[model samples]
Every structure is written in C-alpha cells, then in structure tokens.
Target: MNTPAALTLEAPAEHPFAPFVRILGKGKRGARNLTREEAREAMGMLLEDKVEDTQLGAFLMLLRHKEESAEEMAGFTEAVRERLTAPAIQVDIDWPTYAGKKRHLPWYLLAAKCLAQNGVRIFMHGGGAHTAGRLYSEQLLDALAIPLCRNWQSVNEALDTGNLAFMPLQDWAPHLQRMIDLRNTLGLRSPIHSLARILNPLGARCGLQSIFHPGYQSVHREASSLLGDNSIVIKGDGGEVEINPDTLSHLYGTTAGVGWDEEWPALSARRHVKPASLQPEHLLALWRGEVEDSYPQLALLSTMALALRGLGTPREQAFEQAQRFWDNRDTSI
Candidate 1:
C-alpha cells in the first residue's frame, strides 16, 4: 500500500508591492532610496489601495524614518496629481494649510481674505484636525464666513463668486486623508504630510508651502523646481503659511525652474507672547476693525507680502500693496 502519496503544497506567492517594501526596508547595507520612477509607482499603488494594511504601515514608517527626498516627493506629487479630476480654474495662488496653529491664531486666513477682496483668486486646501490641541483652519471658516467647498463644483463656484475657496483633503483625496488620519495609529507623521503640500492640484501659477522642520524647506523648494512649479517654502508661524511678526523668517522658493532664497526681517522689534487660547471669533473682529492687536496686524500683512511677492510684485511693493489691501478690505463679510 503506497501509503497516501507524499503530500505536496505550493508556497504562497509574493505580493506585487513586496519589492517596494524591500527597496525601502532591506537591511542597512542593502536598503536604498527609491528612484523617482519607483517612487511614482509606489505612490500610485498607495493611492489606488492596492497594497495590504501591513505593507502600507511598513512603507509609510520606513519613508518617515528615512525622511523623503525631493525626488520621492516630486514623484509622489505626480501620482496624486494624476488622480485629481478638477479642471483648471485660473487660481493665482495655491495655498496648502496642514499644520494647525498652536502658538497663534491663523493670520494667514485673513491675509488670503484681504487678497481675495482685492481680486486675487486663491485656492486653499487642508486636512481637518487629526492632531489634538491645535486650532485648524476649517474650524474657523464659519466664523470668517468663508464657504467650505465640499466638491469641485462648489470650489469653482466659490472661486468665481468670492475669488477664494477652502477645501478639505477629504473632499478631494479621501485615500490620502485616510492616511493622514492614521497619525494616531502610526504614532508619527508620514510622507503624506509633506507630499500633500506640493500637490498644487489646479496647476496654479504660484504654490505656497509652509514647513516647520528645518531641512524640509529645501526639499520643498527643490521638488517644486523639479515639477516646474513656481513656489515659496517658508518656516512660518506655527508651521502655517502665516509669517511671524517677532522673528526673522527664511523663504526658500523656485521660480521658472530656478531656485532662490530670501530673508524676511521681523516686523516688530519685540517678541509677542503666545496667546493662552486661540479665539476664532477674534479673526472676524479683527477683519471688521473691532480689534486692535499689533501682533495679528503685522502677522497678516507680512504673510500677505509673501504671497504678493509670489504673484510678481516687487519686495517693497509687495509689503505696501499688502498693507493697502488690508486697509481697503471690504469688512462687512
């Protein structure tokens, strides 16, 4: 009796995404950064949800550990941009606000409002509050009466009517928004945080990014250059695009495929103290001229100057024009 023939079983096949994980996570001597093409493919898989949960977590954390390079960021941005379906809307500036403010109110919102009131079309996007203890821009939109656009159609309408619109990442890129929401589970920020800032989905003429980390300003600048995007990267107040009034800020940027750097001097000689709590209502009050705070005033004007410079205004003229826009703003909103 040939006893039951010796049993044979087939081994499981390797996953398609395993190669990307190995490319990033292979041991110290073997691991290396992904090429731009490889990064584009990897990010495409992520956006398509073609990878497993375990693989997703590992890939994200490994990228976080290595800190994304400009090539990787550019490729990832390309993947995301490829998936965007919004038609071009003739926006003058592309503003990304991911880092919620902890040290001060979001003065940049008022600056954008001032510009919009003066005929500059601005497209702003953000991820809603995923991290606790910070005030997010979306939370204050109601106070400012800025329409929170829920779809591309609404965004187009808002831009046409008011020259400004704010959209949350969830509305446009739900997969990426889900990845950002994993901050609690992952216990660290992922490359998605940086990648989202450079998307510039509508192909706006100017992309403005604010990063808190020291070296990331260069990464953003170079990546924007690679993408042929005219962009400015700043280490702004609380990591939002709003310039701080009390300290000097460095602006790293790329224009027409060339990189440049600028130093913006402090607006005030004395450092302002952080507020105990951020009041959303104060934004409306300040816009309406009911509040008189020097800190927010300078913060708003200086932030607008950065954007104005991005729009081709000369440096001195940018500051003067920003102040004029603020003074001439229609405050009855």
Candidate 2:
C-alpha cells in the first residue's frame, strides 16, 4: 500500500536569521554576545528588512536584556554607516539629540547656536517625541530658527549658510526609527536608541553623545574608540547633551583612539530646582538676552565648553572660549 500523505512533506527550512536569535537565546550557559563581524551581519540584515517580525522582536529584547557590548555597538554602527547615503558636507561636530527635555529646557540648543554663530559646522539628528511629557528638539525648531533639513542637499545648504542643521532620524534611517517606535510595544528601549547616537553619518571630526542611565558612558566611550571616533559621552541634563551646572559631571570619551575621563566641576554650589513649566519660547528669549536666568546661562556656557573640548580644546581653554562665544553672541533672535 502507498504511504500516508501526511508523511510525504518535509519540514520548512530554518530562517537564516534564526541562528542569530539562537546565539543570543541559547540559555544561560550557551548564550553570549555576538562578535563584531556577527553583529555587523545581523544588523545589516535587520536594516535590509530581511529579519522577520518575531525574530526582530526577540533579537531586540534579548540584546536589551543583556545590554549591548562595545563590539556590538561599534559593529552595528558600522552597518548603519555603510547604508547612509550622505552628501560630502564637511561637518565639524556630530551632535545626536535623542532624549527630549523633561525637567529642564534644552540649553544645549543655545550652546549649539552659539557655536554655529561662530562658524562651527554642527549636524544634529534626533527622533520624534516617542514618549509623552517631554519637549523634543523638533518641537522647538521653529522657535529656534535652526534649519530642519529633509535631505542631504538641504543639509549641505544649511551648513554652508548657518553652519548648523538638524535632521530627523526617520529622514535618514527609517529602519532604525521604526525600531525606536517599538518602545511602547516592547515596553522598553531597544539598542537602537544607543546605536543611533554613535552613527555620525557625515563622518564629523567630533561626536557628542548623552546617556541618562549610569554605566553607559563607558560603553559609548569604548565603542567610539573601537570605531576610531573622537567622541565625548556624558550623563547630561534630561539625557540630552546639555550639561547640568548644578552638579559635578563626569565625561567619558576617546581622542585619537585613546580613551580618557574627566571631571567638570559644577557651576553652582547647590542643585537648581526643576522648572515648573518648559517653554519653547524661553529658549529664544535666553538667546536674545530678553531673559537673564543664571541657571540657563551657566548651562549654556558649560555645555558649549564640553563641545569645545570635544573639538580638541584644552579644558581650561575650552571654558574660556565658550564664555567668549556667549559674551560676543549676536543676540538678534
């Protein structure tokens, strides 16, 4: 008699992405972080939309649980850089502003404006307001009058005219932006949040990153070093790259492929109270000299100093130069 039809078919072939998931979820004794090459391949596939939804979720969560290593971060960044279709705009600084402000205003914007006014070519990129109750950079773009670039041509023009520009993550890397959008679905931030900070898409000479969580400063530092990136990572106010003038801040970074750490003293003796409300107009007022708040002034100066330091100025000289930039600002806003 002929064999039953149920036994005639073969099982489906395993997904190529399955091995990556298995490598991460192979139980306590077997699971480990992906090597740099493996991470690059995995991220390459993810960016190409070759990974399934289930596999993507699993890989993100697994990596999130274990926390991504420096190798993984560097490798993932490499994959992203390879896919970026950036123009030949010469950028002096790569500033990634992912975290919006909750308690304090984004004093860092003023710092960037100050630098831009003095001819530092700054490229700032960020995501939309994924979380509630926080004021994102894009929301204040109109008030700040900073150019919002939609494409590389616009970015090139903005930099040439104003020495600064802001681009949204979705405009350049939609796949990574989609992963970030899954914050609500995943109930936690995926590694994309951190990886995006290190992308420096135009290959700027200096990169600045801010991490809110403890211990991530070192991760960024090491990852930047591995990528040969001259970068600074700090636990800044509200998780943006604005320094808090009320408390001492620790900066972790790499310069010329060498890792180093520094401590910047607080500008104020006591911590400043959080603002009752965050007003986007206040940023304009502060820049135009209509407002004279000591807290924000110190914040702007210190934040600019940090950026200057990243641009290779010595610590003392950076602080002095930042003060000069603030004092000599156009204040025409």
Candidate 3:
C-alpha cells in the first residue's frame, strides 16, 4: 500500500525491530520496493492490530492500486508460514489455500480431509472473523467433530490419526488475527487479505487449488509455478481451490513458461445442475461429515474442477473429480 513518510516509527527493541524501522522510514515511497523481511514486519503490525483501521485500509487499497508485487506477495507468505503447526501426514502433497471456508461449505477442509484420509496431509490456513455474513472456519470443523487445533503437536497428531489438522492464524499470528476488527470497522479488505490467500504455513511444496476471480488466477500461477510442471489451479467458489462438478465447462490453466493446456478429455461435460434447494442440504452434509453430496456453488465448483483437472486430463476426467466424489458411496476422496 501507500507507505507514507509521515507515518514512520522507531520500534522499541526494546521494541522488537526499531532500527530497521528507522531505516525503512528513510526508504523512498515511490522508488522503494518492500523486501521479504520488511513485508514480514508489515505483517507483524497488521496482524498484531498495531496498525489503525484507517491506516490498514489505506495500506490495502494502495497496495492493490500499486498491484501486489510478486516480491511483496512472497514476502507476506512468511507470516502464513510462521502461523501453523506443520502438517503431520506422512504422505506428501501441496495443501491449497483453504482461506475463508466458513462462508459456505468447508470445501478446502473437506478436500484436505478427504485427501488426508486417502493418505495426503493438507496444510489449511484461516482463523479470521469479521463480516457478519461470514463465520469462522473453526466452528465448522468443530461441528464436524474435527478439532480446530493450534500447534504442530496437535496438528500432527490429528493428521497421523484422522488425517486432518487445523492451524488457526490467531494462535500463530495474533497480530494478524486481531486484524478482524480492522476489516470489520473499515468495511474493506486489507493487505493481509491478499497475503492470506497465498499462505503456505505447512511448508507445503505444492497444492491443487481453487482461486476466486479469474483476474487473480495469474497471480496464483506466478506465485507457485516453480513447484512443478503439473501444478493445479481452479476458479474457486470464493477464491478457494475446491471445485463442484455438477456445473462448469472447460477449465483455463497456465504454467507461465511451462505452457498452458485446455481442451480437456476426462469427464463428460454437462449442463449445470439446477435444483431449487441444495445449499442447506450441502451445509448439513458438511456438518454431518458427509462430503459426497454436491453443493450449489453458483457454478464456482464446476468451474474450478474444469480448471484444475483440465490441466492434466481431459474435461471429463477433471469434471469427474467432483462428480466421482458426489456419486461415490464414500465421500472421503
């Protein structure tokens, strides 16, 4: 965001990081680009609630105006990295950004749990509460009998046993967690919001994802394109990485220099499902730990599946990833 010269401060070392702050204050507003370490400091202030609401809003809007630079985004990822107990699952897989799942179906958690059950360990991040329209994800995990854990010890234990684990940002980054008030009062997303989606707290090497807004699709790709030649990305329900198979058409995915692929060949592409009332049903299923039922995602689910699966297989295979889960007797996948 807009780094104002007048707002400079000398942290106490006393203040944790005062000298660096003094130097940063000297940084030219327009000429300077934030470093990873500097970004972490910003995160500390944002997360700790040290930044005032107005300032926080300004930071976010300005940052967005300037466009969240690749370095800045990567730097911000540090806080997310520091905010979790490591995933304990022995099997390796990239855990997608399961941010803000309490808004609807705990899609990221479900996908994580399903993958975990199938021998994959997932690293999901989120513990934010602000908008009245949204609820905390921990509540959903609790409803499903899943422990909303706080550290590596508990997380690893859960992963080893139930193939699931939770690492709420509040526990790891209270500074960031406390920002809920900032967001609520400001009525806008802060720089932290952008940082939240790109989190990789578990040190996960890769993940299959469903992202929100096609505009952001490119950022996700650029952020993690180095992880693999076969990286997966989806247009999520709300910027998340899960897909609903009942709807969606061909997916759009790219690997930057790695090459982009479309023309999927996996599952049978079909018309969108149009039942009158399935949101409640899917919500109920989520709490009951029944993940097989497909939720009415307003086409987000279908779109994501097409995008992620279409990367490797044909459209049918990608679409089937969601369909197979819905039609199967076991929804654990």
Candidate 4:
C-alpha cells in the first residue's frame, strides 16, 4: 500500500463552562438550552470552581433570562448530589427551605417538627440572609433552640436522637451557597434556587418542595422525575414548603417515576393577611400553646398532609392522620 500523508487531527480545546454559556448566550436568534448531559458537565465545572466568575455570572443570568428547562434543572441537581458526602441515613423526607418567608412566620418549621415527632426522619437544608426582609429557615429554627448541624455526622446523630435535623447549605454545599448569595449582586433569583430545593442530598424517599411562581410547578415536577426522586412540589406559603390555607394550591411531582398532578382545595375560606412584623418567637409560641392562629394551624395540617401523601399515605387518610397529629401535639414540648 502506498504510504498516505499522515493526517493531523488536532483536538479542539475545551473552555470551562464556555460551551454552556455560549449555548444560552448565542443571542435571541441562536441561543438554545443545554442538553441534560451538557448541563451536568457545566454544573460539575461550576461546583469544582473550574469556571471563571465572569463565565459563572453570564451563565446564570442567561439561564435565568431564558428560563431553566426541566432537563437543565435536573442535571444541575444531579451534579450537586454526586458531589455530596451524604450520610447513610434512610431519610423519610427531604425538605429544602431556601425560599425563606417574606410575609409570614415559617410555620413550615413547625410542620417539619410535627412530622419528626410523628417519626418522620426529616432532612431539612437551606441558606440564610440571602435576601433582605425575609425570614430564613435557619434563623427560625435557631430561635426555637433547634441545632443547625455542621456536617453529615451531626445530621445523622441528631436524627438518631430526634427525627429532626436542619442543615445549612453553607456547611454541606458551600459552593452552591456562594452562588445563592449572588442574588444580592444579580438582583434576581437564579437556577440555583430551583436546584437546591430538590437536591435531596440524603436520597430521601420523599421530597417536599415549593415554588412561589405557579409556572414553575411543571418545571419542578419534570425535573424530579428526571432525577428519579419521588417528590411533591406545591404552591407553598411564601414558597417555603408549607401550604397556603387560603388559596387553592396546585401540586405536581413524580411517584415511582410516574408523573402526577393535583389541585388541592383551600383549607380556610377566609384570606389571611400577611403579618405586619415577622416574629421568629411567634413560631415557637404557637407551637407552645402560648399563642394561636387559625391560618397557621390550617397551614400546619395541610402541609403535613401533603408530606404524608408523599410518603405513600392515602390522600384522604393522610389528611386525617395529619389532623390527629396536630390536635394531639404536646404544647409543653
């Protein structure tokens, strides 16, 4: 055989996160969403700090401006979960409370505590002070004397002692927390908020998430399905995983990889006003029987019912069970 001229095949150099940034920033005519795999790789680079800050900011804003797709959100969550040093725990529920409370007390904290008391091993994670004029979960939990765990071991230890444990995103996934903090600079929420809700670091059997925007309900549902997580995304109070008792809320999620959606009726007929002031003590005082409110009480039951249904309880039966738990809560505790 005649010796052919040697072919020179040079590999194209890959720039960290540049491919993804370009995919979203190709202008209106050419911009497109990243595939799931592309998103995963890009997010991996983000978590590893392999991308420049300029690229990170551009990528985030582009995604925000375009609106994140289900595949992209799933990929980001999966990438984060892959990097987590998750403790070996059979978590009954994964509750992400990053949205914080702007209008009301974090009654969801009380709901989680009630579920924990009822033997639901809840793994709650969130960030704090990321937004002005909002009451964060960590602050509210701290007010009630609930310890915020520093790491996986402490989380497991707390769950072993009591069915409840709250972990701040800063301790578990500092990289994502840093990105979340960029909200102040960016002046808008990013995809990080959506990804954090369904991170499910411990691979809990049930995930309870919330979205303030109604349009995100389908986005979260499809994303959870892509992650193979059995989760319920609800229009929660202040988007903090607690049901709004006054409004008919929509629910969406996956169960055993099958997608489902339902509309829940308003538990209370009267519309409740957002409080003039947020008192963290108000959460504890309500739980301790020193204070009482109809709205918070209904919110607690409805939210717990959703969590129960997420854990395989029958829909109507779950509500009944949740009501009993609420009625019998020991006020002194």
Q: Report the C-alpha displacement of residue 211, candidate 1, in angstroms.
A: 0.8
- Winner on TM-score between 2 and 4 is 2
**Tens digits of per-residue lDDT for model 4 on 228-324?**
8899998888878998889998889699778987888987777988788987777878898887799889888888999998999877899999988
Q: Is candidate 1 or candidate 2 better by lDDT?
A: 2
Worst 10 residues of 2 by lDDT: 2-11
Off by over 4 Å in 3: 1-57, 79-110, 226-231, 244-333
Q: Model 3: per-residue lDDT, tens digit, 15-41? A: 444333433344355335467677767
Name the regions of candidate 2 deviating beyond 4 angstroms.
1-6
TM-score, predicted candidate 4 vs. hidden true structure: 0.93
lDDT of 4 at 211: 84
Clashes of 1: 0
lDDT of 1 by residue, 123-183 (tens): 9999989899999999988878788999999999999999999999999999999999999
Q: Give me candidate 2's TM-score against the actual structure.
A: 0.97
> Could you tell me the TM-score of candidate 3?
0.65
Per-residue error (Å), model 3, residue 103: 9.3
Rank the models by TM-score, top first.
Answer: 1, 2, 4, 3
At residue 117, candidate 3 shows an lDDT of 47
